[model samples]
Target: MTRPLRLDALAYGGDYNPDQWPEEVWHEDVRLMREAGVNLVSLPVFSWPQLEVAPGVYDWAWLDRVIEVLWAGGIRIDLATATATPPAWLVRSHPEMLPSDSDGRRLEFGSRQAYCPSSPVWRANVARMARAMADRYGEHPAVVLWHVSNEYGDHVARCWCPESAAHFRRWLEDRYGDLDGLNEAWGVNVWGQRYTAWEQIEPPRRATGPVNPTQLLDFERFSSDALLELFRIEVDVLREVTPDLPVTTNFMSLLRDLDYWRFAEIEDLVTDDAYPDPADPRAHVPAALNYGLMRSLKGGRPWLLLEQAASAVSWRDVNVPKAPGRMRIDSLQAVAHGSDGAMFFQWRQARYGQEKFHSAMLGHRGEQSRTFRETAAFGRELQRLAPVKGTRVRSRVALVVDWDSWWGSSATESLPSQRLGWLAQARAWHAALHALGHAVDTVRATGPFHGYDLVVVPNLYIADAAQAAALEAFVASGGSVVVGPFSGVVDATEKVHPGGAPGPLRGLLGIEVDEPWPVPDGAAELVELDGERFDAPVWSEWIEASGEASVVARYATGVLAGRPAVTRRAHGAGVAWYVSAALAEGGLVAVMRRALADAGLPARTRIDPDVEAVTRADDETDYTFVLNHGAREVAVDVPEGAEDLLGGDATTGRLVLAPLGVAVLATPRAAEPPFVTLSETTD
Candidate 1:
């Protein structure tokens, strides 16, 4: 897991496709890039077919010229292996390379990423092309990082073809060791279906009846592993050719198909492609949540914001343009969270293709446009803030992000409510913490939680015995825990545990839920806490205190009215809070405040509610970012003697931030011990 050479200035740029335009446009593109202060650009992301003329021959003349031009222009290259899209001739020759949908429908080559993940020929071609690219451009002075296959599992994640079925069988063999083991894990006896031989197993396709839940869970896991293996193949070739080269793949964090935790162990850094919908009011929190999750992959190390929409994207049905100053705030927002680099999907807007309408730094109208002006200003500001590099975002609260739970919950229709999205619940808690001015980290559920003041297990829809044990130990060690609705209801295999709901965690939580009362879509019930009533929506559970727990909130109106809607327990000198239903922002913030207080943590800052402040620190300086995402100006309280790194000036008193404004302040950093350090004794 090597990273590229440390950048003197924050890297800024996006994917650059020079081959699409005439040779004359290349010169102007470079000049424009220089004007916008773009120091890094990803090249040839979709140029696989352009490089390979037929089968084995590669015409690298065009690519070599592109590299030399960008290098001469003083722009670093995030060089792509260009194995994203294959040549039509190869697919026509070997149609078995095409992936199939769950319904056994073959995906054609008209779109990108249509190849089967299990096809050996596809793997061979991708690796061959990767090696050729690495051998040719690995030594290029401008090349800084190697971007592996563009966004794996974007379109063709799971396939039901014969080749894929064979691969699935092999993966099952490796996982289960024997048919009896597979039967036991899958609980095949449920439907009088048990596999006696390897040949009897098949991919979960569009079957005549419902597929087994355990079978589907394993299939999803196997599919993710297949894609990971495919990526490993290309990365192996790239590393073999250039051992020191840092390699990365852009991850779409919201996509549930790929298991990014396992992928993070292989990819050099947790580089992700993030596109926040302008229409969603709560979009920024999820964006920050994803960024925090990405940064968490490297143990609080800074990560790359690989791709974001400059103004608008082409995929959405009603793509809205980002208002003036929005781009600058969002770009700086990335840096404030933990990104060493900020990049967009495209540097210049495409003239043709499905994504031609996608917004870019230099739009179709060129440098005179508003987008270009903002891009230039942001780049110059990033250049002035080089001291902020190498700093990491520190969080006192960690939200367990379990991909297994995500896949199992979403894929199964039998779950309480389909609206229970994994990230949605996690984002709810993160949003609550952000409102309270507490920085949060979204780490994998399996990661160690040694130094967090609070560990929020949002809808532990699925859990394991070991995971439950760890949480119990964390609570016993004086660490506060927040267990969201329906937590610990299912085990690791997506199976309901034998005990009552919230299973093994009943002891730590001091509550037992025999059944869940799922509120239908668009219906809500009132939760009353301390004479304040708030609408609790989505889900609620029938709870009874089995231990030393007290009712914090009760359902005011519903079938479970007067029952416990939220509970708190004093457990082993620590506290465990259970939110039985999804609450609106106001209620969640109140609950968060109570949790923080119970954990002996300080209250949130005294800043304007509209402005978000996140502080990242190195050994010597604290870099605080104040961002205004509201529609009106807001007053912010700045720390005394802080320097305005963005404005190149400093001032005390109330700092006013206009709508969509941003400010970066750097002050002498103080030594901060873990907000919650581990000890044998409880606090």
Candidate 2:
């Protein structure tokens, strides 16, 4: 069982870097933190060099004093292991630990995560640092969470150094067992690339031409595993030394370099670092999708928003600051999607360093800045929301998120079209669902589906027989499904399934993919659904009806004219819908409405693109979060007998909200919500 974060109220604060300031400034920082109602702060994330000046040498005076001051001020700590980056001395002595790029150039030690994931030297040093931190402060009164190394695979996800090559060979040996098995799995017979020995296999570095697709896919898998191994090493030590405290490393939301599904399983608590761009008006749609994934990672448990910018981030080309009231709405949107509370990247803005320009809770103006004032007000809002701390968001719709499929579909450059990427396809589908006012939860392709009535497979580019069986079982048990294009094409080995596209799901979806006809650049395509034409871009396929399936939509233009662009079939007790083209937003919403009706679900008719409604509940009360992200005022319908938690007023019928407005309405819970039981469903 996963251990939850030990906290009385909802957590609030950010990364506290007392090491960046002198001891005299520490007291002032604590005073400001108290005024802001900050309860938890992640400390010393990148303090390895300061903690250990020399090899095996310690300097605990500064950290100990900082902790004492924080504890004295009644502030809780999310203590970090300070193993995010290697010290200059350690990297200077062991140059082999430095990571190298795919171009055979070694990356220096100036940046974070400069060490190679597969480096033994780096592993040993990090383990030592983790043990030392745990031994000293594992049982400290103020320390509630033990945060391991900073975001894994943020900088050096893959390294082409000699050490990594050796590690990859060992990993492949353990996976494939022998040369024949390896050759068979990799399809090495093609291009005369059969490997006679393990040494012959190398990391897919700069090649003369296109490399083996399976090799690239395996390397992607290996890269994720390598970083995961690093995290496991630190977690094992932390668990051994400090078994009570929950251990977590902040996850980069929707990051493709590392697989979060496997990583979340090892964590005691799942946390994420989210920075939705302030420039994009519709960024909240995708942000909701990411938060949904985080909550579902542990079966609808609440996750923490560990790090978000107070205003504009420094990394974008033209960093745009959040408008006046946008910060509060942004933070509340996260809480609405099952985040316990909101936190930022840094407590105080850095005067010097790479992130000096990045916005922080306390900007360069200290307590007088607008950022701090907004943060303090938000803190008060969280205190008011004390009743919503442990509540989870129960969703009946499940969106399939498979990292293997994400990596496989976009890993190699040999795809039919690069325009239809995984994230784009997912966001398109999620936006449709969001506009329909349905709270969607994420599920792995091979997980239990009993808790959900509708499952949407945005794009499962890589799938096997077992995954197909799981979907079949879901449909057979009176559930609804919607699958996107270019799915069920390849298996785990990157080899095409025995049949063509929709391989095992051909019977379930009742369609056969004749060919994936990608639309030409600068070309206009259209698909007619229910006598209404919608623009179809990037992708369209020549699909054939193989089983007892109903043609729902057909291509109205181009060479595939009059071909089935969408199909639906009834499998046992449920129905399955498939899309053979990348339809526009209007078409997607129309299709989703039909699927919802087929499953006896009511699709919201308002379609306010900028307004978001998400419900989270426990046993007795339901908290419905209504947020308006548009520039104009909007009126939202409130549940009957609902009371506003923030405004402290009873409201019913229509509640008018200004631009960038938010309201949390609390109402008596209707009925028992469904929960996912892993053992109830079979893969």
List TM-scores for all candidates, in order. Answer: 0.95, 0.98
Residues 37-93, candidate 2: write the lDDT tens digits: 999999899999999999989998899999999999998999999999999999999
Q: State each candidate's clash count.
A: 0, 0
Model 1 stretches astray by more than 4 angstroms: 605-609, 671-683
- 1-683, model 1: which lDDT tens digit per residue? 55655457788999998988998889899998998899999989888888988888778998888888888999999889888878898999999999988888888889899799999999998888898998888988898899998888888888899999999999999998998888888888887888889998889877767788888888999999999999999888988888887889999865789988888888787788988887765567677777887888778878888898889999998999888877777788788889997899899899999999999998888988778888888887788768877789867788888878888887766667787777788888888887777667876655588878788888787877788788888888898999898788777666788885787788788888878888898899888888998887787788887558999999999798999988998877678988988887778888888898888776553423456777888887788888888887666656666788877778564576778877787877765422211112221
lDDT of each: 0.82, 0.89
Off by over 4 Å in 2: 672-683
Report how far residue 551 has shifted in candidate 1, in Å.
2.1
> What residue pairs are clashing in model 2?
none
